[model samples]
Target: MKVKIDLEKCYKAGECYYNHPELFKMGEDGFPVVLHEEISDESLIKHANEAIEVCPAVAISLED
Candidate 1:
């Protein structure tokens, strides 16, 4: 899976970070900073899906 976050669509809600800190981190400005953009592992997909669900800005996305 490939993951991406649109900065223009992000409003610094930080839910994505909270849901998947291993791959998503909150910057000093409180916006999400993508730590990993390409995900091939099965375990991380679970967190990625949850992050997508909790992101208020809807900035997180996953592509197969």
Candidate 2:
């Protein structure tokens, strides 16, 4: 699965990047940035899911 973010739906809540720095980061424009586009690591995938769950804007998703 790959991590994808809908910038239009994002509210910059910082939950994704703050809690899962290994999978996400704060972008230059203050948006959440996906650090790893493709999630093949099992541990990382768990982190990704956590980020998705905590995103207030529901902007994060997984793409196959």
Using lDDT, give the best candidate's number: 2
TM-score of each: 0.83, 0.93
TM-score for candidate 1: 0.83
- Give lDDT tens digits, candidate 2, residues 2-35: 9999999998989988888898889999998888
Residue-by-residue lDDT tens digits, candidate 1, 1-64:
8888889999987788876789888888887888876888888988888888888888888987
Off by over 4 Å in 2: none
User: Which clashing pairs does model 1 show?
Assistant: none
Which run of 10 residues does model 2 get worst, by summed lDDT? 32-41
Q: How much lDDT does candidate 2 score?
A: 0.88
